[model samples]
Target: MSLCFFDYGYSLLLRHTTEEAIATCIEAIEPARAALTSQLRNTVINDLIEGLTKHDWFTELDIADEPPPVRFSLREWINQAKEVQATVFIAEKQEALVKESWEVLKQNIPENSLRFFTLVLEIAPAVKNMFSFLKDSDEIPQNNPKLKAHAVKVFKMTCESAIQLRQKGEVVVSDTTLKYLGSVHVEKGVIDPHFQVVKEALMRTVKEAVGDQKWSDEMGSAWGEAYDQLAAAIKTEMKQQLEAAPKSSSD
Candidate 1:
């Protein structure tokens, strides 16, 4: 009878332990699962809008066929830019959503900070695209000087981050440079002389773009290597920026 009673007691203890473990798991997962759902919506905005902006359907603003340069309608172009800008604004509004989601995630899975940060990193490229969209907006040039300045600020920030990340081994330098080059192809098509000019100009500006920083000898050599490829790829973008920079209609 004592042996049977002891066996029953052990079973009860095991059952209690199992129940507690299950409860702990459910508590941990509930908030994280909810946060993941919210993050899904954020991703929809950042990724979807970015893909729309970066699409290669970027035809030259010149649409007429008669002679020298075709005259695309400024009104129509500006209207399109307004629509895109609205989308970006909508995405920006979701900043609160991202914060809430991250809070839940952090509370539930504190150990996953780096993973969450990396997930946030996924939106970095999309953020860059949003800035590029703003930069390419004819609306800013025609109607809003303030917005044009904001767009340039965003572009500068992205360029700075890309350069720093490349140097620190925090991100892929070549890929970031390529993305910048691709953005430059908006007004300037992938044609010959223009493309070559832009690429060269981008290379020349890298050091200035990144700002002056102290690096060890090893880092300096690594930076030199990274700079070589980026210098070649960024020429097209640099030339395009120079052409666009001074021609704001807000002048």
Candidate 2:
């Protein structure tokens, strides 16, 4: 059987009580499997039979000219179902943490963004040259209209990227935006080293905004993973675009 079938069967088992009901649902969904062939159907049936046996959901009955007896173990099925439930419960808890922390962070986008840029510049002063608006300023100026606008835009983009990463399994989040951003940054001479600086700056900003009492290690990990994915996508596209561009006369 295909991994898809196993996944579907596992999902059904997670929702239903009886193995028979699960089997019925699986068979019922056969019509929706697109171009399913007889051989594939048989394979799926065989896989189900094997899975049921492995999970101790089978029984044998003595009869003439009939299929063998198959006993279903309710206790075993319930145990397996609980495992799936536990996984889902943990995922939901993590998602809730991210959302809750994000709500607090969004309340002060401008402040957090300022903190982010300030931290970045403090860690890597040379990066300041990349920002034209801050060229004449030695420090991240507070309440500068241009700085505030830039910060707000960056914060919003960060939030959007995180949300897309969080829901990636359920929905398709195109990397086109990130790719374009990467290309633009590359044109401005931004390189890979800047990514780590941005990540550190953003993490510090988030921690300061949300407070240590509310932020957990899991939340930090989730945010890190999300940013890493976004950064990687951007860097990859940037490299691809740079490679495709014609070499300058200097090169």
Candidate 3:
């Protein structure tokens, strides 16, 4: 969490600072050297950067500052800020879209989970067999209690992971969860093809839940991309299990 804040600190510093602060900073210490620690300067200079930043260094402006290069360079800073703003803009929008859709799903877990699995089977009927717990006797997920339980768990995991992608920027799967998922996937013969089927079904289910009013290309893309990261994590663990298992040799 602190690390995320640390990263954002750099972006905020560049995106928010004014040309005045830039000029002041350059005039005080050549970007490469600090007045307080420079060998050429035996005496300490004013901490204008700190004071200006805390007081009014970043008094939100409609137009960005275009600072002329002094002894220091502004090219890199300007370029980096532009890149950071573009990336951050996408991440922030995704987080909002994910949270907005997730709220609806959270409100009615059984209904949404049922809808999700129904889409899965509709997309690929054979995919239903992958769920050993569902059994051949179960016609569809609507009447199956296990389907709802499993669906809720999986759907919740997906949304939570998607929601936190920008907040934490990485998946933090536990050892136990990894082992459990790998074992189940191995038993079900789950592979990339099956994963793709489920991913599509999920995207469809989320779109249906959110409705056309809130749904958009960007929202779908956000969920799809986040799920891709999560599916990668699961696949990595499953690959390890497959490699570690003993194989039968030609006799």
Point to the candidate with the largest lDDT.
3
Candidate 1 overall lDDT versus native: 0.43
Off by over 4 Å in 1: 1-158, 161-187, 191-196, 199-251
Poorest 10 consecutive residues by lDDT, candidate 1:
110-119
- How high a TM-score does candidate 1 get? 0.20
Q: In model 2, where is the ten-residue run with the lowest total lDDT? A: 164-173
**Once superposed on the true structure, which residue ranges of model 2 sit more than 4 Å away at CA?**
1-91, 170-176, 249-251
Q: Mind giving the per-residue lDDT tens digits that candidate 1 earns over 22-103?
A: 5665556544554554465556656655654665564347755766876645444545556766754543333333233233
> Model 3: per-residue lDDT, tens digit, 1-251?
44344446545656788878756654554323322223222211123333334554344334335555333234433444555556756776787788788888788877887788788788878877777766575467477778888888877777777776755676656789778878888888888888898899889988888889989999999899888988888899899999999998998
TM-score of each: 0.20, 0.63, 0.67
Ranking by TM-score: 3, 2, 1
lDDT of model 1 at position 78: 48
For residue 166, give model 2's deviation from the true position in Å: 1.9
Cα deviation of 72, candidate 1, in Å: 66
